[model samples]
Target: MVNVGLGHAELSSTHSNGRVQEERRNEGVVTSWCIAKPSTDDESLNHNIDYSCRQKGVDCRPIQPGGSCFNPDSIISHASFAMNLFYKSAGKNYWNCHFNGTGLIVTQNPSWGTCKYPA
Candidate 1:
């Protein structure tokens, strides 16, 4: 079991190979989120949003006006959402979260109210 603060998730596994030989693998899912670093400047954050939003699979609609995450509309808020979406969609990897060194991977969810950061 993994305690992710949000809740506990049971670890799963899989078996492979034929009856003659077998292999087992634990398919544990780790939840994580990416967001703009607190120290990142407005310019950098905006750049991250621009770059991330342009990428495929990154839905920037949530950050648009009248969108669920549009309130509290600020560079930091919007950038965090866009960067996280890009990181999640691009493949949750260390490099994916490295938005010119302005991105951070956090175990704690950055979600709030209707703003849900994907994991």
Candidate 2:
């Protein structure tokens, strides 16, 4: 299961309606961190972003964790800016973006050393 944002919100598998389903709940204030691992293709980027948004309880479409298109250089830069803003507003470290394999990964509560950005 992926921990999206604050609230204990998780995407868990459920067995209902004769098929497996995804259940979402507002648990309140995401405490655990989340990671998005994408494949090495642009087509998968959208799925990755969707996964992240679902995990975070946010409206992130056309982009889900493990998807490809989600790794735009401009998007990464913008994400950094948003992370900085979140840190400043909340007075707590929040989001981070990094390149791994042929894709990008977004993580929370990530170690500073894990960042691939230039110093």
Candidate 2 residue lDDT tens string, 8-72: 21123433223212222337544322333322343344343333344432433222343221233
**TM-scores, one per candidate:** 0.75, 0.22
* Global lDDT of each candidate: 0.70, 0.30
Q: Please give the distance, in angstroms, between residue 95's alpha carbon in candidate 1 and its true position after superposition.
A: 0.5
Model 1 clash pairs are none
Which candidate's lDDT is highest?
Answer: 1
Largest TM-score belongs to which candidate?
A: 1
Point out where model 1 deviates above 4 Å: 1-27
Q: How accurate is candidate 2 locally (lDDT)?
A: 0.30
The stretch of ten residues in a row with the least summed lDDT in candidate 1 is 3-12
